[model samples]
Target chain A: MMGSLSGRYAIVGVGTSRFGKLQGVSTMGFTLEAAKQAIEDAGLSRDQVDGVLVMMPAIMGEQHGWAARVAAYLGVEPTFSATMDLGGATACGSVQTAMAAIDAGYCHTVLCCFATQNWPQGVAMQLFGSEFQVPYGDVGAICLMAHIKRRQQYDYGYPDELYGQIAVTWRQHAQLNPEAQMRKPMSLDDYMRSRWVAEPLRLFDCCPNTDGGGACIVTSAERARDLAKPVVRILGAGQSHSSEIIHPRGAEQRSLGGTKAATMAFGMAGLTPSDLDVAQIYDAFTPRVVHDLVAYGICASEEVPEFVTRGNLTFAGRLPSNTAGGLLSEGHLSGFGHIREGVRQIRGECGDRQVADAQVCLVTGYGGAPHEAPPTVSYSALILAR
Target chain B: MFAIEKPLPRANEDTAPYWAAAHKGELRLQRCDDCGHVRFPPSALCPRCLSQHHEWVKLSGRATVFSWIVVHQSQHPAFNGDTPYNVTIVELEEGPRMHTHIVDCPNDQIRIGMPVEVVFDRVNDEVTLPKFRPAKSK
Candidate 1:
C-alpha cells in the first residue's frame, strides 16, 4: 500500500536494567548496562554494533552528545550514531529509524537505548510542560489527562471506575512481572480509595515514575536468523505527529494523532487489528490506554467502557494488553519498555505472562504533549512478528 | 496563613501586546488583517493565510466553561496551598480559548457550558492576570 518496508529488519535482542529506584547509577551507567546486556543477548560482540541511537537523555539529566558518548563508553565507534527525541514515543521511534537505516545499508546492527531517573525533582512535569502552561496551573500530565477524562465523561457518561479497571488490570499483570516496579496487588477498592493526584484522576490512575533503562538491538531479518536468539521481525512501522498546540476549545481534544500512524502501520503490514496476538500499549496514564485502543481500531469508541469491563486485558483474556504491566507498573522507560516487551512476547520468553500461541504483537508509543493543554502530538506504532 | 508567589509569564515580541492588554484589564487577541482569522498565543504570521499583517483587537471576555479539571495535587511550589482549585478551559465568545481559573463559584456548582466573564487579578507588582467568575443572567 504505502512504499512498504515490511519484514526488512528484525529485533534480535532486548535488555533492561533493574527498573526501580537505582539510586547511585548515572544515566550513562544505566545505558551501558542495558547496551551490554542487549549485545550479549543478541550473541554478538560489542564490535558488531556499528550503529547506536540514544533516546531522551534529558529525562535523566544527561548532557548532550549522548550517542557519541555511549558509543565511546561501549568502545564501538558506530558508523551511525545520533539521538532520537520523540518524548514518550522514542522507543517505537527508534525501532522505525533502525529499520530504515538497515534497509538502506547505512549500518548492519543498531542499538536503541534509553534511561531515566524516575521523576527526579519533578523532571517529568518540567520536561513536558511549558512556561505558559505552568503559570496558568497546567502543572503535570495528571491534570492534563484528567481534563480529557472529564470531557469523555461529559460526552458518554463513562463511569469513573472505567479508568480504575485499567489500573486494576495492569496491576494484575504487574504481579507476574518480577521486573515491574509496582507489583502490589490492587483491588477496585484500592483504586477507589487512592488519593486524587488530579480530581477524577486518582494516584493509581497515574504511572509510577520509575528509574531505569531499556535497550533493543535491530538488524536485517536475514542476519537475525543467524543470531543467538529466536528472531522477531519488525514487520511494519509508522509514525505521525500532528498539532503541537493544544486547542483547548476544539472538539474531542483528547486526539493523540496516533490513529494516522496506527492505520499506516496496519496498511504497511497488510494486517488488521484482529491479527494482533498481543498488544503492548503505552500507559503513561490509564486513560491513554483507552484512547490508544480506540485509535488503533482494536475496539469501537463507544465500546471502550464495556470492552475494558470484560477483563479482556489480562494475559489469558480475549485481548491481552500491556503484558509487562506497562509503564504504570513495569516502570517507565518512556515507551522503550513497550518495545522490549513486544520482542519478548514474539520470542515467547515471557514465562508467566506469555500469551498462548502468540505470533504477531502490536506496540505503540504516544507522547509529546508540548504544553500541558495540548493533545499528544507524537505517536508511533510498530508491528512485530515471530 | 499562606502566601502564593504566582509564576509570571515571560512575554516576548510575539506575545508582548497580548500581555500588555491584559495588564490594562482588556482581553485582546491578534486578528489577521488579511484573512479575518483570529489567533491566540500570538504569533508573527497568520497560520491560515501566512500574512504577517495583523491587528490587536479587544473582545468581550464573556465565555463558557468548555471543560475543567479540579487540581487536588500540584507539583509546582506556588500551588501547594491551593489544592482543590480549578483550572478551566473557557471558550471566549469571539471564538478563542484560554486556560483560566473560575472564581466566585464553588467547585461543586461548576458545569460545562456555564457562562462566565473575566475579572483582572493582580498577581505581582508588574503583572496582572485575567481570571473569570460566573456571569449574571441578562
Candidate 2:
C-alpha cells in the first residue's frame, strides 16, 4: 500500500509567516498568513483548496475542531478536514495524513499547517506525566533530553563535544539563512561557555521560543507539475508510534521510532540513505540529529560522533543537513520550518545555503509525550525527490 | 507558609493501592497472576499478558541507577529553592523503572548501574514519595 502511494503526491508550494517574535499576531493569525501565502505560491485560488489539516501548538492551549476552525476562517468548505496533535511530529505527520487522504480520494489539494505563539504562557509545562514526574522536578523537554543524552553518554560513550559540534554547525547554516532566527555566528568556544539548561544539555542545545507559522500545499504529482513552483515530489512517507512510556522496564531510552518509520519510508521509495542529497532533521535538541542519523541508516551508531565531527553536515560535505538551521537555529515552528526548507532546497531556491545539485531531501519529525513518559514515541519521515 | 509547594501525585482507582502501600513504608506494585509480570503506575491489565487478575506485591526496595540527570535549571517555582537537584531513573529488582530522586548522594556521584534502595519520604498527610539512596551492599 505504501509503495503504491509513493510518487503520487507532491508538495507544490510552501510559505511561512514572520520567523521570529511578532507581537501583534495571534496563533490563528499566523496560520491564515501562511496558508494564504502557500495558496499564492501554488498559483491556486483559495476557493480551490478543498482540504485542510492544522496543528495547534500545545503551549497556546488546546482548542476543539481547530482544522474546522481554520477551514471556516480561510473561507474554504472542504470534504476532508481535521486537526492533529503528535507534539513536534505533527507537521510532518500532517503531510503524511494529507497524502493518505488524497490517496483514499477523501480530498485533493490539502493545506497542512502549524503555528505557535509561545509567549506570556512560557514553555509548555509537563502535563502528561504530572502524577509521576512533576513532583520530582523532571519537567520540560530539556530535562527529558538531558536524560537521553546522559544515557547515550553511558551507552555509546558520546562526548559533550559531539553535541556542541552539532550546535555550532547548525548555527553556521543559520547565518546563511536570512529567515533564520539565531543567525549570529556561533563558535565551539561560545557553545561550551553557554549556560546549561540541564547538565548534559546546554542553553545552546535547545531551540528558542518564537511566534511563527508555516504551511504547504499537497496535491497529486500531475497537478503539482501545473503549479507555479518546481515540483518537489513526495516519493515516500512513513509514520510510526509506540505505546511504551519511559518508566517501563523494556522502554527504549536511547533511540526512537525513527528506524521503523525510516525503514518503511525507504522501502516505499526504493532508495537507501546513500541517495539522500540533504536532510532536515528535527532538532528540538541537538542529540536528536545523532539519533536520527543512526535511525535512518545514514551511518553506524558508533560512527555518529565521528561523522558529525568530520563536517558531514556542513554545506561543503557529502550530506548537508538542517541547511536552514533546523529548529535549533531556525526558530521553532515545530518541524514546519524543516519541511519548508526541505521543499526550498529541493527546488534549488536556497540561495547561499543550498546544497549543490540537491535531488533527494529527507525531512524527519520526532517527539511526543513531552517528558519522555515515552520519550520520542512518535516519529514520521518524508523522502522528497525532484 | 507551611503548605507543601510541590505538585503531588493524585491516586485514582488503579493507583490508590500503590500510594497506600507507600504511605505504610512499603513499595508495592501490581503483579499479574497469570504471567508473573509486575507493572508500575498501576494499570488494570497486564501489559505483557493482558491478564486482569493481579495482586499487590511488596518489593525488596532494591534497585540500580539506570540513568540520571542533574537539573541545573528549575522548571517550576516550587523547585526553585532546590535548583541543581538530581532526578534519576532506577531499575527495580522486580523489573520496572521508576522516575525518582536520589537522596544522600551528591549529583556528581550518581552513576548508571550503581546500587540503590528505596526510602519513603512522607511529604504530608496523604502522600509519601519513594526516593532512593546509596545501598550498603549490592
Candidate 3:
C-alpha cells in the first residue's frame, strides 16, 4: 500500500553516547560527541557539514536549544540551523527535516542531533502536574494513565500482574543494551515489590530521566551509495501534531484521539505496521505500548495484553519491539535512543536480540497535550529497508 | 487589586458553560448532536463525527471512582500546600470521564468503583473548581 520516493535522501552516518545521568557532561558537549562521531562515521569532515538541525528539551525554562552552541563549538557555523522546541519529540522530526533538506538541495550534508539532562529538572517536573493536579488525587505523570490502567483491571477484568510483565520484559531487553540507563535486570517479583507511583503504575513502569545525545547524517543518496561499509537508507519519514493543547472539556476526548496523528505519520511512510521488522515506539508509560500499537493499527483494539502474553513482541518473535529496552527501560533522551535503535535494528547490530534479516523498522515520537488521555502524543514514523 | 489573585481554573468557550454554570454551582457537560456522545473538555465540534453541533447540559453531579491516584507531592507553585492529594478520573454517569481532585476522604481509603458526589470549592468570588467527595457520609 506504500511506495518509496526515488532517491530523495539517505542517512550516511549515525552516532550516540550511552544513555544515563550525564552530570559531568554539558548538553553541548554531548551534542558535539554525536556530531563528530557522525561526521567521522559518514567519512565526512567537519568542513563538509553544511547544515545542522538540533532537538533538545528546553533547559532552565529557556526556549532555545543547542544548535547555535553546537555550531560554535564545531567551528563550522552551519548555513542552516533550527532548534526543535518540542520535548524529546524533536528527535524524530530532526532526522526527518535533515533528510528533507538534503533532498530539497537546501544543504548537501545535514547533521541531526539531540541532547538532554531530563532528570536534573527532577523527574517530578512536568507541565501536566501544574495544569491538572487539583490539590490532590493522582498528579504528575502517572495520574494521566492511572485511570486507564485501573479501568483495564476492573472494567475489563485484567490482572494486577498485567503491568508487571511489561515492565520486567522491557528492562530485561535493556540488560543487553550496554548504553541503557536501567541496567539492573528485573523479575516480575521485583517489579511487583516496587512501590506504586500511582495506583497500578509502579515506579519501574516509567521512563528514566537520562542525559545523552544521538546524531544522524543525511545526504544525497548519490553520496550514500558511494559510502564505505553499510549505510541504512532513509526509506520513508513522516511526522504529525494533534493541536498542541488538550481538546476543550466536553470535547468528546474519549473517542480516543491523538491516534489521528499516528494515521498521518504512517501514511507519510507509505508503509503499514505489518511491514515493520522492528519498532521503537515512545513508551513513556507501559500502556502507551498498547496505545501506539492499536493507534497505528499494528494490533487490534484492546489486544495489547493478549499480544504481549503470546510473545509477538519478543526479540525472537514476529514483531520485535523496543529491542533497545524502550523508554521504559533504556531511558528517555526524548526518544532519540529509539531512533538509534531503529538504525541499529536495520543494520542488524542488535547481536543476540537482533531480528534475523530484519529489513524495515518503525520509530515514533510523542509530544503533545499535557492533560489529555495521551499527553504529548505527537509522533514521527520512519521506514528503513536495507 | 493590589494582591496577587489566585487563578480559578475556569472553563473557557470550550468549557465555558461548565465553568459558567459552576460559577452558579451547577456541574455541566456538552452533548454532541452528531454522534450522541457526551464529551469532556467541551468543544463546539464533536470529536467523533467532527460535527459542529453541541448543547450544554447540566449533569447529575454523580459519578463513580473509576480510577485514581494518591498524589504524594504537588509541583505547581499554586498547589505547594497540597500534598498526598487524590487526583481522580471519575467516570461520570453521563459516560465520559473528568480529571478532578477528590476531597473529603482519607487518601488511603480511595477505592475503585466507589460512589462519589460533586463538591465545589470556591478559589475566590468568581471561580469554583469541581472536585468530588465520598457520596456516603462518614
Candidate 4:
C-alpha cells in the first residue's frame, strides 16, 4: 500500500548554528540555539511547538534520551518526542517522522534538531567499526569507502579520476559560499596531487570532520501558510536498508538500500528523478555521491562517469547538487546540512549558490559502514516542493 | 613465546569455536544445519534460514581478494609502525568471506580477484590471527 503524504505538512522554518569547528559550545548549546532559531524563524513561540524530534550526538559521547533533555532545556511539554541515532541519516529520518506525526494529528508544530561535535574528536572508529572491523585496522571512514571504490573500479572499469571530478565540483561550489569550510579552489591537478588518506581515496575525496547543528520546524500545510517564511511542502519521505555486510563479497559496488529508499520516496510523491530541480545529496565521500546518484535512478551505474562529467553539480550546472557546498566543504552537520540546504534552495534564500527556479528539491542522507546488523547505516530521502 | 601486543579478537560464547579452530591453525565457518548455508564472523543464527543449529566446518583456505585498501594512516596505536599495511576482504572457496591481511605480496601488486591462501599466525597464547598470502595453487 503506497500511502502518499504529498502536501500534508511543510517546513515553515529552518536554522543552523555556525558550521565548522564549534569549539566553545557544547552539543546541547548548539541544539538549543538552532531549535530556538527555527521556532522563531517559523513565527512560532516555543510553547507552540508541542512535539520534538532530536538526533542524539554520539561524536561527543553525548548521553541518550536527547528528546527529553532537549524538551526540558527548551521548557516545552511536548505531546510527541523521539531521539533518532541513524548516524548521518538522522536528519532526513527525523523529517520523515515529523511529517508523519503531523499528518496523523499527533502534533501541529514539531521541531527537528541535530548537532555534531565530531570535529576535534575523531569518531571514525566508534561510529563505523564493529568488533570484526576494528581489530583488523579497518577503522577509518576513508578506508571503508576506499575499499568499496577499489572494488567498483575493478568491476566497472571506471577510473578513479571520476571521484576527482566530484571533489573538484564540490570544492568549486564551496568556494562561492562564505559558510563553506574548505574554500580553496581545487583543480583536477590539485586533486590528483593530494595525499592519499587511503589508497585510491585521496585527502580531498573525504568530507571534513565537522561540529555544528541545524533544526527545522515542520507543521501542517494549513498552519505553515500562516507562518513567517515561504512554505516548502513535504511531498514524500522513505527509508531502506541494503546488505548488512560491511564488505559485500561481490563485484557489485552499488547500493541497494539507497535505491529502495529513493524509489519509495519518489513513488510516494508521485514524482520521477527528472522532476527534481535540485538535489542536496549526502556527500561524505565522493564515491557515495556516485552510488547515490545511480541508486536514485538519476543515472544508471554504467553511465555514472559520463553523467558526472557532463552534468555539473554547481549552481550554474544542469542538475545542481549540494549548492551550499555539501559536507565536502560545508561543515558536516551530518545530514542536517543537506536538509537545510534543500529548504534554503526552495526558499530562494541561498545568496550566490542558489539554483534558479528550483520548485522540487531532493534531499537524501546516508551513514554507517556495513556490519552484521548494518546497524548504524541508514538511508533516508525527502522530496520537498515549493 | 613472542609477545603479542597488537589488538586481538576476544571470542564470545558464539565465536569461541571459531577462535579455537584458529588456535589449532585451522580455518572454520559456521554452517546452518537446516539450510546448509555457510557464514563467517560466527554468529548464533544462520543468515539464510535464521536457524540456531549450526556446525563449525573446516575450510580449504583458498580464497580471492574481493577488495583491498592500503592504510596510509591509522588511529590505533598498535598499528603505528604498520601504517602502509594492506587490509583485504577475501572470498573463501567455501562461499564465505573473511577479513584478513594480504601478505607476501607487495602493496602495489595486490589486485582484486587475486588468488590467496590462509596462513595462520599465532599472535599470543590466547589468540591466533588468520592471514592470507598469494596462493601457490588454485
Candidate 5:
C-alpha cells in the first residue's frame, strides 16, 4: 500500500538565484526571485499556487510565522502553508511535505523555497549545550565532523587522501558548471595543503557559505503533465532522524541515519541503489560524501574508499554524483541546489554537466547539531525519475 | 591586557545535579532504578524503560578516549588565546560518552581508545567542569 504512493506527484519546475558573494540582495529578495522564476518556469501565475513551504536560513536568525510572511510578500495567500526547520534536510523535507499536502487534497500546487544573505556567523556555536559542550570549546559543526572523521580513520583506517580525492572530483565538476562559486581548478595537492578548520577537516573540506536561493513547484503527476516542463516524477521520498544526546555505546558509530532512510526510499520506489543514473549526495563536508555513499547502500563501507578514490563519483564514472558540483563546488543553498540539479538532470536540461541517458536520480540532504548528543542528525532522500 | 570571559555552561533542572556533583569533586550520573541504565546530561526519565524513579549514583571517573579534535580555529572570542587545544569525547566504563577537554596531553598525542581519568576544573564558584587527563599506569 505504501508503494502505491510512488510517482503520484512530480516536481514540475525548479529555479535558483545567482549563487556567490553579492551585494544588496536581502533574504526575502532572493526568496522572491527564486519563487518567481519557479512560478514562471511552471507556466503558472501567482494565483495558481495555493500552498507554500519555507525554510529560513540559519544565519539570518529565524522569524516567527516565516512561511506566512513569505506568502504575504509574494502576494500569495496559500491555503496550505508551513515553516519547516530540519536544517540542511529542510529542502528535501519541504518537498516531501508538499507532496503530502497534494496527496491529501489539501492543495494542488505547492511552492517550496529557501534563501539567505551569506555572512560569517558561527551558526553552530550557540547550538552546543552551554553546560557540557560550550564549556569545553566544542562549537561549530566542523569540530563535530572532525571527531567523526577521526573516529572513521581509527575504525576503517582509510587513507586521508580519500577525502582529498573526493574534494578534487567535486571541484572538477564545478569547473564545468558556470554558476559554481569556486570554479577554479583544484588539485589533490591544493586539497592537502588547504588550511585546517578542524584537524582532519580542512578549509576545502567545508562548503563555502554563499548568498543564494532555490525554489521548486510540486504538483500532482496528472497536473504536472500539462505543465510546460517535463514532469519529473517523485518515485520515492524518505526521512530519518537519529536524535542521540551522546553517541550511543555499542551502536554502529559510522551509521549516521542514512541507511534507514535509503531503505524506505528505495523500498517505496521498488528499486535498488544500482538502478540510479545519477546522485546528488549532500556535501557539507567531503567526508560526508563518503559516509553517505556507504550509508545509502550505494557501496559497502569497506568499498567506499576505493570507490571514491577510483573516480566512481565523477560525471564519467559509473555513478555520476553531484553533477553541478554539489554544495562543495556549487554554491550552498543548503541542499536546495541538490534538488534543483536532480530535477534538471531528470529533465535533461543541464547542457554540459548532464549525465548521458539519465533517467533516475537520487538527491539526499543531511544536517543537524552533532554536538547536541541528541547528536540530532536528520537525513532526507528523494528518488526522482523521468 | 584584559582577559576575555569564557562562556559557562548553563544548567537546567534536568542537569543541575550533574553540575552540583562536579562542584563537589565527584562524578555522578543518573541511574534508572528500574533498568539500571545510567544517563548523563540528566533526563527526567529512563530512556530505556521510561521510568521516572532514578538515583544519583557516583561513578568511577575512569574512561577511554573515543574521539578528539584539535582546535585550529576558535569560533568564540574567549577561546582565541587557547588556540590548538584538544576537545575530546571519552566513553566512561559505565557506557556513557561525554564531551570534555583532555588536559596535560599534547594535541598530537591524543588517540582513539586512549585510557583517561576525569579531573574537575572549578571555573567559578558555581561551575566545575569535568575534564580528563591521560590515565596513569594502574
Candidate 6:
C-alpha cells in the first residue's frame, strides 16, 4: 500500500476460480466458486457481508443484477450492491469502491465479484455501434494496437522482438503460478515465429480469450484485526476518461500509459513509482505493460524495451512486475485477474515468486482504445498496501 | 456506385485536409510549426506542441507497409462487396501511420516490415481512399 492509502481499507480475503474454457458451467457457477472461496478464506459467513460490488469491463451485465443473483445464490443479500462498469478500467476501481464504502460506514463487510465467460465473439456491450465492427468483429484492441504499432514502426523502427520480450517475461512468471493459463515457458523464438494475427502484433502478443472468475471480501480495518489473516489496506486510487474515438484530441501527448488514472491513484495514496514493492499493470496486450510502465513514470518511455529485456520484470528481478502472470499468461478475466494479483501480492501468499515483503502494489485497468490518440476510454489505478 | 449505411467519421476541421489530400491523389500531413512534428489524418492543433501554426505538406508517395490486416469480414456495406480485403496501416516515414487499404500485393507475401508505397482509389465522386501496393512493383 502506498503511504497515502496506508490505513484506509484492508483486504482480509481474496479468491480466484480456475481460468479456462468451462463450456458447460454457467457464469453463476464460476461466481459462486470464487465467492465461496473468498468467504471461506475470510472465515466469514455470507450473512456478515453488508455490501456487494460487481466488477466488469463494459456492460456485460446490467444494473448489478449479477451481483444480486450471486448474493442470492450465496444466501447472503448484501445491504448495499453496486456495479463497477468502467470497462476493463474498473479492475482497481471496483476494489477501491468497496474500500471507500467500507471506510465511510456505508457497509461493514463487502463482497466483490467478477466473472467473465464471453469469449472469442466478445459481449454485447455498446458504447458505440457493434455494427461498426460487425464487418470485422475483431476490431477491438488488436486493431487499436496495430494502428499504434504501425505508426511507431513507421518512424521509430520498433522491432517485433520487443513484443516477444513482453510475452516471455510474463510467461516466465506464469511458469511459477500453478493456476496460470499459459504456464508453459515461452521464448522469443516461439513468439516471433507464432502465426500473425494482425500486421504488427502476433497471436502471442495478444491475450487469449479465457473464462474465469475472481472475488474478494473486504472489511473494516478494525474488524480485520480480529480476522485470522493479515489485512492489506487501500492507500490510494485514481481514474481518467478519454474521448470515444481511437485518437482523441491530444493523443500524441498521451501514450497508452494511462498516466492520468495512475497519477490520480498514486497521489491519493501518497506514493510514487519507487515506493512500490510490486506492480500488476493492466495488460490486455504485451505492449500495454511496457506503455503503462513508462506512462506511470515507472521508467523512461524510450527505455521500456530495454528495461523489460534486462529481466527487471522477471520473477527474480529487482523490480518485479505482473508477478501473477498477467492477462497474457494468467488469463485475462478482462481486468479481474489484475485485481486478484494485487490482493495476492499484498497478502504475501504468492509463494516462491512473491516479491519479498511486498507491502505496496500498483494496479491499473484499461478499457476501450485510443480514440483520438493512442489510448481512449476509461481507466483507473489503485495502490494497495499491507 | 454505392451507399454508406453506417456513419462515416464525417469530415471535421481536423480531418478535412486528409480527405482533401486523398481527393487530389496527394498524401498530406500537418507539420506543427511549433515543434516540426509531422502527423497524418490532419488535425487543427499539433499533437507534439499544440501549436496551431503549420502547413499541409504533400507526401512523396513513398512509404512502407508497416503493418496490415487481411480483414476477413466487412462491417460496412460500403465494404461488403470487398470481403477478404486488406486494411493497411502504413508508416509514412514522415512520422504518421495512416489507415488505408492495400492493393496489388499477394496476401501470402505481406510480411511485417514489407516495403510498400501508396496509391489512391476513387470510390465515388466524393471519396478517394488512399491505398498501398508492393513498393518493388510500384
Candidate number with the higher lDDT (4 or 6): 4
DockQ agreement of candidate 2 with the native complex: 0.72
Q: Candidate 4: list runs displaced more than 4 Å.
A: A119-128, A244-255, A369-376, B1-5
Worst 10 residues of 6 chain A by lDDT: A129-138
TM-score (second chain) of model 6: 0.84
lDDT by residue for model 1 over A1-386, one digit each (tens)? 34467887899888987778776677777888888888889999888999999886655555678788899999988888788878788889888998888777889999999887654553443334554567777776676778767777787788878989898998999899888899999999999999988777788989887777889999998898899989998887889887523454256445547788998898889899989999998898887888788889988779988889888787666789999898898888888788888888888899999888889999999767645433446889999998
Lowest lDDT 10-residue stretch of candidate 3 chain B: B1-10
Ordering by DockQ: 5, 2, 1, 4, 3, 6
Docking class of 3: acceptable
Query: DockQ of candidates 1 onward, in order?
Result: 0.61, 0.72, 0.27, 0.56, 0.75, 0.11
Superposed on the true interface residues, model 1 gives a C-alpha RMSD in angstroms of 2.3
> What DockQ would candidate 4 receive versus the native complex?
0.56
All candidates' chain B TM-scores are 0.92, 0.95, 0.86, 0.93, 0.94, 0.84
State in Å the error of residue A275, model 3. 2.9
lDDT of 2 by residue, A1-386 (tens): 77998998999888998868876677888999999988998899998798999985676565888889999999999999988888788888989899999989999899999888766244454344557777788887777788878877888999888999999999999999888899899889899899988887899888888788999999999999888999999988888886433546353633455888899889999999999999999998997888899989999889988999999999978799999998999888788888989999999999988788999999999867755443446889899999
The runs of at least 3 residues in candidate 6 whose Cα sits more than 4 Å from the true structure, single-residue gaps closed, are: A1-6, A56-64, A119-138, A152-156, A243-245, A250-252, A255-257, A369-375, B1-85, B88-138
**Arrange candidates by lDDT, highest first: which order?**
2, 5, 1, 4, 6, 3
Lowest summed lDDT across 10 adjacent residues in model 1 chain A is found at A119-128
Candidate 3 per-residue lDDT, tens place, A1-386, comes to 22344235667778876557768776777788877887887788788888888875454345454677778788877877887755546777777777766656678888888777654443354343322333343334566666556655665566656667777778878888877878797888897787776656677777776777788887777788877536677666666665322233355444444465556555755667788888887788876676667766787756767877677777767787888788888887677677777777777777877878888887777764355442454566666666
The parts of candidate 5 lying over 4 Å away from their true place are: A120-130, A249-256, B1-4
Model 4 lDDT tens row, A32-110:
8888888888899888999999987766565778888999999999999998877678888888888878768898888
Per-residue lDDT tens digits of candidate 6, residues B35-106?
Answer: 888865466777668798998888777776655666443433555566565666566667565556667877
Error of 4 at A195 (Å): 0.6
Q: Candidate 4: what lDDT?
A: 0.81
Per candidate, the number of residue pairs that clash is 1, 1, 21, 0, 7, 26
The numbered model that scores best in DockQ is: 5
TM-score of 3: 0.80
